[model samples]
Target: MDSFLSALKISLWVATSSTLLVALFGLALAFVLARCNFRGKNIIDAVVTIPMVLPPTVVGYYLMVLLGREGIVGAPLYQLTGWSFLFTWQGAVIAAFIVSLPLMVRVARSAIESVDEDLIRVSYSLGKSKWETFVHVILPLARSGIMAGVVLAFARGLGEFGATLMIAGNIPGRTSTLSLSIYSAFQAGDDTRAGQLAWVLTGISVFVVYLAGKLSRSRWM
Candidate 1:
């Protein structure tokens, strides 16, 4: 019971944190992609989208190469601050953020793109700056879709398993999230525990999906 609770807590924390990051950066990236056309834009979009289609293990491998102690990014950071994300909850958050980012970006981009260009032009005609137009007009118009993207990203983060396991390992009360806990229990032949955890995760995922669908169909403006 304690382990279950710990896993639940960790999973929620990781998912929430990753989702917040996804919402901020994903929205910005989506806006840029929607409003701008630059050289290599397609390449950037493809890179962002690739993780969604790649196997989770492959993504994990990529993360490991980039974040391992001797890795290009990790080595310099470790030498400077003596901090590493390996075998830590922070690592889990990174894994979740990367894997879930595409969902947020894709959905938010579509939403921003769907906003009426006439409305944007009118805002500009009124001497509104691009920043002001985005904050006031664009965001309000795209609220529903952006919210849907957030929900989906949270769901994806909550269920992240392979990449998290590879980077964070399964340290109880530390990095062991619900999905990782399920894997641990099953590996230990604890069918009962695994089933319970699975059901809990399934229920949460179902609720998130339903909410996202509802938000996608809703329009406040």
Candidate 2:
């Protein structure tokens, strides 16, 4: 029971943290892709979205190569800050963030793109700066879709398994999330516990998806 609670807590923490992180950076990327014109824009979009198409284990392998102790980014950062993301809760967060980021970026980009250009032109004519127009005009219009994306990302993070297990490991109480817990339970022949956890995760995921659908409809209608 304690282990279950710990897994629950870890899953919630990782999901929420990753969702917030996704929102912060995802929205920015979406905005840039929707509103700006630049060379290699299509390439950047494709690269940012590769994870959505790749298998989770592949993403995890890349993460391990990038953040392992002797890895290029990991080595320098570890040497300077004495921190490494491998096999840690922070690594779980990163894994969840990476896995869920594409959905957030795609949804937010569509929302931003759908905004009426006339409104932006009016804002500009009214002496509004780009940042101000974005904050006041674009955000309000895009709020519902952005929120839906955030909820979907959070759901995806909560259910992240393959990548998280590879990158974060199944360390009980530290990095073990609900999905990992379910897998561990099944491996240990605890079918009842696995079923219970699976049901709980399913319920939460369904609720989250329902909310996202509702928000999407409300925004589009």
Which model scores highest in lDDT?
1
For residues 39-121, write the lDDT of model 1, one tens digit per residue.
Answer: 99999999999989999989988888899888879888889999998999999999999999999999999999999999999
The RMSD of every model to the true structure, in order and in angstroms, is 0.7, 1.4
* Worst window of 10 by summed lDDT in candidate 2: 212-221
Q: Give the runs in model 2 whose Cα sits over 4 Å from its true position.
A: none
Q: TM-score for all predictions?
A: 0.98, 0.97
Name the top TM-score candidate: 1
User: Per-residue alpha-carbon lDDT of model 2 for 181-220, expressed as tens digits?
Assistant: 9999999999999999999999999999999999877754
Model 1 vs. true fold: TM = 0.98
Clash pairs for candidate 1: none
